[model samples]
Target: MGWHYTPYGLPYIVSGLVALPVAVAIWKRRSMPGALPLSIFMFAMVEWSLGNALEMFRTDLAGKTFWASVEWIGTVIIPVAWLAVAIQFSGRDEWLSRRNVALLLVVPATILVLMWTNDLHGLMRHNVRLDTSGPFSVITKDYGPAFWAYVVYAYTLLFIGSTMMMRSLFGRSRLYSGQAVMFAIGVVVPWVSNALYISGNSPVPRLDITPIAFTVSGLATSIGLLRYRLMDIVPIAWATVAGGMRSGVIVVDSQDRVVDVNPAAARITGWSAALAVGQPVVEMLRPWPAAADACREHEIAANGKGARQSEVVQEVAGGDRSGDRSYEFRFSPLLTARGRVVGRLVVIDDITERKRVRDQLVTQQRALAAMEERERLARDLHDSLGQVLGFLNVQAQAAREQLSRGKTSLADGYLETIVTVAQDAYEEVRENIRTMKGVLPADWRFAPTLERLARRFERSYGIQTDLAIPDEIRDGVLGRAAEVQVLRIIQEAMTNARRHGGARHIQVSFAVAAEGVEVVVKDDGSGFEIKGLGGGNGRVREQDGVRADAGFGLGIMRERAEQVGGRLEVRSAPGMGTQVRVRVPLRESEEKAQGRDAHEDSGR
Candidate 1:
């Protein structure tokens, strides 16, 4: 059998016929975010299929070569268009800057130039002739490195472009995944058929079946446009989400390639947004090995371990930031409605200031507490000893008057009174010192401390004292503040009985009642006039620096009790007796805290 030239057949005519409207439809929606690139792809397919059909029908070498050059226009650009589609579909249109697009054009333009000037350098084809061995007339040539170079470049685009498209499909929403699935099918059909042809392993070896394959691709793309409305999702994502974010956000497919990274994400991670796109997550995070590891682990858990609902928290320390900084990252699975894990969404928040503020708050609280302690000490000194010292000066002056009146026995008794008051005041100061050292906040322990005060009064003044404080009072029933108030009140009452009222016996007791804890101190002694020294109200005079405010002790006691939501009563009369009573109330919650503290102290 003899070989002959073949003309346009049923397949070639049909492929060209099918591609025209599909190209127009795709072009019509070019204003969509990703559709511009898609339109370019469909248009290239129209040129390649139509020109290939015409070239195959031409029965002469000159006619076939001229049509082959026209076919090469789409052939040279189809891969570029496919790459652009991948870029746009993945929400990375930022990568296609004018400079990068021009650089992409450079190689393909050179290839087209070489094909046009093939007779001059024969770089594209070393020798050319009309092949009569196949059913269709086609140009046959001994191909050069330039021809192989074009082959290498096209396949490179195909492989990388397909990789990006597949990643786009993997972790997308249901509607998006369906549209991407169709786009993937559109992409795969031509490559598979072309690969078979280039390797001479196609089902029809000499027949160029790529155009027929492209026809199928165009149909699939058309179906995606009509069925899923792929174009609408892009503007929605761009306008509302991707552009407005302040926190660093990154999206990655199961392949771990960065499918999308916002400006904030790129800046925070120290990568250019355009350069970072299509890069492996590991490579982008190389400066942070721990973060990189976490990124890989989270993706694995999300996609493989079925932890689609789980999130991974990673703390990243230090970066290209101006000062010391920390960022908290939260990585979660991007899952479809069916619960299939598709991608990972990583969010980064700067937490350096938050940590610093927390530390500052703790320091301020400690300093404020110290300042309050010092203020409490100052107030304690003024209330207790200041009043006692002034009273002693008054008693010493009275004793001198008695001696001038030639009553030596009365003067000796007055001298003894002054000594007892001074000794009690000294002991009170020592107790305050111990309280300041460790007891804290105000040292109001009523049990042994108050009982000791009563006993000391007995020894100093030779005034037999009666003391009865319950076990609960000794176990710190009152807060330090409350304890100090009640104890000081008792000390003042005892001193006044011996020094002013001339009492021989003083009794102190604690009784619990429905009102609260009640402390009563009574004395059988000479009672002073209550009218001048706060008969009921705690009003005291402050003047003369020596005998000023003789009733200041009574005033302080009353004020202290009232401050802690407690009450104080004073009863005294000239040459009769004196009795002091106080009631203090406390919250149940404070009582529980006291118990807990006591238990902890006991353990120590």
Candidate 2:
């Protein structure tokens, strides 16, 4: 059992030692997808290298044969471990089921048993002897039937694993290319080395250089682990992430050809990946033409000179057996490392539930806004027309009382007052009806509408109404809602002047300011104290020397101003005329729009 140190066997020893740390490093990252199996593969390489090295260093034939048998342990494990690494690395981990693993181990396990029992049956190897040919002694033997059977099984697995590794070279990401190249070299070098040794074409006679070949394989794997970050950034198979995702992912090349389609995409477009790939994307996505057109247009733009297209997102509606479904397709360009446009990545997200929720919320908001408008109308009627009607009823009662007392002149005066009150009430009713129809004209001609309103006011109330609207602020300046609100505020001001302040002359003017449009309604009427009006709500108490009903109108006008991102101000004294100035911004704020929408939702 003596052993001699052989420089020829030193390379195998160095390979085994070098592989030890690599195997340990991979084992430490065993939590990663392919790390555990890869670590096992490295460990098998270490055993096979070291065991062969020890066999070559042994002097006795029995010692050499014993070490050769020991080498079979790693030899038997390498193929299955390599296949497992390939499967896990390619993201086909589901194929490594317990049943499938046991089945894969069956042949390797049989070969191991036969190898250990080879002395009894000689099915693994025979005619084993130590040959001191060339620089060192090496074990030589004629591989028997069982050994050749294991060769066929091991080669089959290695071939499959090599094919999987090669397929990763053509993946979408450039990051995986380097890792795949390293893996290919690692798998192929050892495979070719073994074939050369088996064919007796080894450079050293009777010397198997397969273990030394593993040194090259180990070096390739080490480079991949260090430089390419092999196990850290795994190259997942298409089925792993893209196929399992709920969103549909479609990859189209620059020529508008469908390069890849995930399972979710297949289900969405009603075309399998096999049928979709290599076909024209426009034709493949004919059912979703909007998505196809988006991809095609982006590709066309990308291919054009000086065209830098951005990502596009569009929502499309498609009907299924259940009902209509909404899908949002996002098109993004796939650029290579050199900044060249290679393809487009289309991601389709099913947004049916989001759309349904949004529509329902919108309907609810509309219903709430209608109800709020009705309530506002009811309040207006109670404040203006109802009071007029009550006064008319009182005057009629007085007229009847005077007639019953035989006071003809007094009754006649009361009758005339009633007629005047009834006429005013009729005008107020018509005005309310017009206001309820909305203040903005069908054509949205702001200036003419304001002029018409001023003229109508002058005719109806016998007041001299002057309008000084700027020629620049004629049309298309304000949004429709802002126009409606502005007109309503002006109308409210004029009505209050005639009904409450007994104004004989009213002037409405508009001025363009740096911020926005400024509207001023000045009236020569008996103005009340500005302090008489309450805060924003304009709810004046009886002690405030302002009619509570008048305060309601002021509050509404202020609210209208605020709705258009504006402010309302009142300036007045006991002897001076009152001035209502409102400044509305030209541009709407997002916060203001959201607040208005929320207010409508809450029916406020």
Candidate 3:
């Protein structure tokens, strides 16, 4: 096998060399969509060009024919590979299944076999001979029906692939449009060269310039790879990811013009994507003034020096015919490799359901607080008013009995006591009503409220009330719920001192302990035995004028203390004064905070 070199074949060698690096570059990114097929396409171009260059250097007919057959190997693969790249790049990868790809290769594979066995059948080429052309010896042949059939098949695939790339020119970003334009040129240049060669219209006879034409195609792809980052950022993947998202996505350029809007964004903004592109972003987002203002603010911040990519999230409310809806808008700046701001990306997420659930939880909490308030009111009425009414009944019967026995002076005394007791009950009823109405103001101070309660107790019961609270205790803060419970406990203690123990004087003092504030209420009165009060039920044997079950107020006071994360203790013995102590933690527990919130709700 002898070979001859000519200057005419150098361009093919250069074309083959130029395509080598492009093929390797694309192969490196083969994991991306369309990359594998595009790399295969470039590899096929390399084989065709180099094989044709070798065919031009071969002097003998057999050597030239062998290289031409080798060139046919790449020739058959190019069209099918190009079609596959188009399908994958256009986001139609589902169509490139194994069975479908195999079907696509059927005609190319058959043509190659027929060309190899054409000596016997004359179906691929007939009357093949070596033509010593202007600058080199090249093989020339008359194509047969089979060769024409392959030509038609190859052209059909090229046309389809080119058409798909052309469609990407409109309604796409400048990056994608530039990539599509380069691909379209790559596909069309080779097609036109092949057509000229087939029609015998080539400038040089018997030399197919189709392989040389591929140099232009390879250069176009290289430009796309470098300038537009075709393999790195595929537009079809962007479309599939952003278009199918439930959240709205909008992209704007540096000038605040709408570069792209996904379908979800179009629905959210009530603007069509086709019409929204190239419009001013401020005008497009006019319906949501807050969102528009956020975009403007982000753009201004992004333009500053050393500005890095950051996301700003804010909740926005919009009203419609049904009701108000909430949405969370997330704004992020789009930056270039040089850290220059290029645009902004906004994502809108609907949060109406979340807001609705939150409001429903608040409503349920208020209802629960109302129920708790009613229960507290019931306990207060039983502890104070019920006991007063019972005393009035007993005193009225006593006065009637004295009058019937002709003890006029004793009856008159009983009447005077009844009048005083009636006035006290009236004041007690008014105080209970004020408590039910949540009379504790928002800025209510613990010491002042306690002092006022002591004064009222002194006036109602004719008992000398002494308060010995420290400066720290007076200045300390307590949650409204805990404060209310503490005051009620003190009131109950005072009442027990007067009624049950027949106390004359009551002393209330506070001391700061290790864990919290400790309150002590002492009375100089006829104290009952502390025995039989172990079970929190407040059951005790009868002592003095108090009934066996008259210790119910003690049980109620213990419950109120526990509700506010506190503890209560009572000490008493016969002929000794009664002392009630309560310890309340300084820091509110989770349970206590919830109770405070409930108390506020009831107040509202």
What would the TM-scores of all predictions be?
Answer: 0.41, 0.51, 0.56
Best by lDDT: 3
lDDT of 3: 0.76
- Ranking by TM-score, best first? 3, 2, 1
* Candidate 3 error regions (>4 Å): 117-122, 171-177, 229-258, 262-315, 318-604
The 10-residue segment with the lowest total lDDT in model 1: 540-549
Ordered by lDDT, highest first, the candidates read 3, 2, 1
lDDT string, candidate 2, 1-604, tens digits: 8999888788788889998898898798776556677788889889999998998788989998888889988988878887887786565667888899999999988998998898999999999877776577776778899888888998899889878766655554443467778877887888788878888887776678887786677668667765665643234424333567889887765556666778888888787876776687777656666766776666666667744467778788873421477888887766432233446677888899999999999999989767766876787677567766777788889999999999999999988877876776676576557667765335546677677777656644578998887765775466677877898899889988887678899998888765688899999888887677777655666532456667777888898999888899888877687899999876434346778999996872
Q: Using TM-score as the measure, which candidate wins?
A: 3
The clash count of every prediction, one per candidate, is: 4, 0, 0
Clashing pairs in 1: 171-342, 444-483, 444-484, 501-526
lDDT of 3 at 52: 90
Which lDDT tens digits does candidate 1 get at residues 1-604?
1222355455766777777777787788766555677677777877888787777767778888888889899888878887887776566667788999999888899999999998999999867887877666667889998999988888898778778767656655442557877888887888899889888998976877887887787678677765565543332233224635888877665556665678887777877656776688778766666677788778667756558667888877775451477777788876432343446777777778886897799999879756755754565565556666677778789899999999999999988988877877787787777655645434344676766777766655568998887776776666566777777677767765665566788888888654468889899876656666645344444322212334755765686678777888877766668788888864454566679999997874
Summed over model 1, clashes come to 4
